[model samples]
Target: MNFSAPSGEVVADRLSDFGIWEAEYRQTLQQFVQEVIQQAETDLEQEPAPSRPTDVDLQALLDDLRAEIAATRFALQQYRQSLSD
Candidate 1:
């Protein structure tokens, strides 16, 4: 027994199924969006403030260069200390 129709009944049923699927799909999308927003907020909460250069601020490209120099100095001092010991 094969039943098929080009009538409004089949169209209505197909549209109802599509409506249900769209609602569920929308809910899933909303959840993912909310999760991303919350994760971003949490990450921002944990992040340190960015050091911006101002008139009073010592922050510069030179600061990073100085840090590297200080690290190398410390390492060299440690090597010299180890050799002396």
Candidate 2:
């Protein structure tokens, strides 16, 4: 065991831990993205289809709203996780 620098075994352990964290973080992000897409589709379906509203870009608005909700939910989840961590 080298006191001045960490041994290869310690470095390897740290790398493994980082890999696990990265995998978990990626999974969470992927789930959030899918949820956002699904929510946008739901919102579009629930929106009222007006006959005279030709200028209303529903898809664009829905996309924006979906992104906003996803970001908010992601941050909230991260905050909650941080508290536990």
Which one wins on lDDT? 2
What is the Cα-based lDDT of residue 77 in candidate 2?
100
Candidate 1, position 24, lDDT: 100
By summed lDDT, which 10 consecutive residues of candidate 1 come out lowest?
A: 52-61
lDDT of 2 at 42: 100
Report the number of the highest-TM-score candidate: 2
Put down candidate 2 lDDT per residue, 8-41, tens digits, no spaces.
9999999999999999999999999999999999
The runs of at least 3 residues in candidate 2 whose Cα sits more than 4 Å from the true structure, single-residue gaps closed, are 1-3, 53-85
* Tens digit of per-residue lDDT, candidate 1, span 1-85: 8987678988999999999999999999999999999999999999999997567544676898899999999999999999999
lDDT of each: 0.93, 0.97
Q: Cα-based RMSD of the predictions, in order?
A: 7.5, 21.4
Worst ten in a row by lDDT for model 2? 1-10
